[model samples]
Target: MAGLHLAQLNIGRLRYEVGDPRMAEFIDNLAFVNDLAERSPGFVWRYEDDSGSAIETRPFASDPRMAINLSVWDSVEALERFVWQTVHKRFYGRRHEWFERMDERYFVMWWVPAEHRPTVQEAVERLRHLRQHGPSDHAFGWESLPAAQLWKSARCA
Candidate 1:
């Protein structure tokens, strides 16, 4: 916790375009969620564009509907608390209504120096490493956490 921060990247395939009627609810809630994260305890940083929304930044040029979120927190516990113990959990519960099911693991987490902010390419590379090599100290998911770890409280059921 002294020198390291947790960096995470999660990519989702959207079932519909951001402006589509089907995605309206998700779109409407995006700002609120973003602001919540900004105010959440232990929040460090999040990737955003000039509009302060990451949704418009298409990381995967081939798929216009691919949405990615990259953020940093003081620890896994901080991130888990925000994700599982807040209103964000409600939207997360309804993710399937806005996002398509992904066949592969779409999330990855790794440790970074507290002062370091990860780039999109670096986050993608870590995700690729996890996909190709499975979890390790370099890249991991909730499954990689030890049973006694704080992640247990935040782990998805």
Candidate 2:
């Protein structure tokens, strides 16, 4: 558990295009939320492109409107604090206004080596695994195992 980190991937399908007026607020706040994540305690890394955010990256081939966010945190608590206890929470509250409500699971979390930077392919596979197998050490949803057990069980697998 000494060198383990938490890697998380969350995807959402936008109800409108990034430049659409309907999504103006969400688009406007992307950088602020990303900045908050970078400044949060226990923040490690986030996937970004030349524009400094991954909002425009199309990792999911099947859906062009799907936006992917991948990042690593020192612990589950650190990620939680950034997600639920910051300005990002306001955006989260209004997600339904900008993004479609997905029926399938749109996010996954897993343990990775401290230095490992997860790729989009890896995140996609984890999401697929979670969808197909429910919550396991390899890939899980929000109601995941404790970090200690998750690392141990993932190692054993």
Candidate 3:
């Protein structure tokens, strides 16, 4: 038996208050987008609730002004296929239409063992570590996979 690979997710804000009048409409559209993903192919699972949010234990940033949307995915191909191939790619391209280009630190990816979904706090810590240290000895992204794949029986059904 082997552990599953999870896509550690993170998306930052454009401005301080993304829910402001100017951005409210866009934020509201998130529900529609999420709904699309929930039913997307390769969508093993997503973290959200009726309120259209999952919980976050960390401050969006050191200033605490920004916020993050973190979630898990079954695989990099799955997530990338969604983010790039899907309509979602348009929003990502236009993110600067809202968000600031801080650094690579703004978005990151890491691996997690199956059955051990990370908490917001843990995700934050992993991002912080990635910033302080480089990719080695800890986390990596879509471009990197272990020499050996850790495949497991599908729990999807």
Candidate 1 stretches with Cα past 4 Å from truth are 147-157
Q: How do all the candidates rank in terms of lDDT, highest first?
A: 1, 2, 3
Off by over 4 Å in 2: 146-157
Top of the candidates by lDDT: 1
TM-scores of all candidate predictions against the true structure = 0.92, 0.90, 0.76
Better of 1 and 3 by TM-score: 1
Tens digits of per-residue lDDT, candidate 2, 25-101, equal 88887898898899999999999977788888988788899998999999887877777668876787788899898
For TM-score, the strongest prediction is 1
Tens-digit lDDT string for candidate 1 (1-157): 5799999998999999888999999988889999999999999999987667788877778999998889999987788888888898888879999999888889999999999999988998999999999999999997775532544554442
Predictions: Cα RMSD each? 2.1, 5.6, 6.9
Tell me model 2's lDDT, rounded to 2 decimals. Answer: 0.84
Give candidate 1's whole-model lDDT: 0.86
Residue 65 Cα positional deviation in candidate 2, in Å, after optimal superposition: 0.3
Evaluate model 2: give its TM-score: 0.90
Q: CA shift at 97, candidate 1, in angstroms?
A: 0.5
Identify the superior model by lDDT, candidate 2 or candidate 3. 2
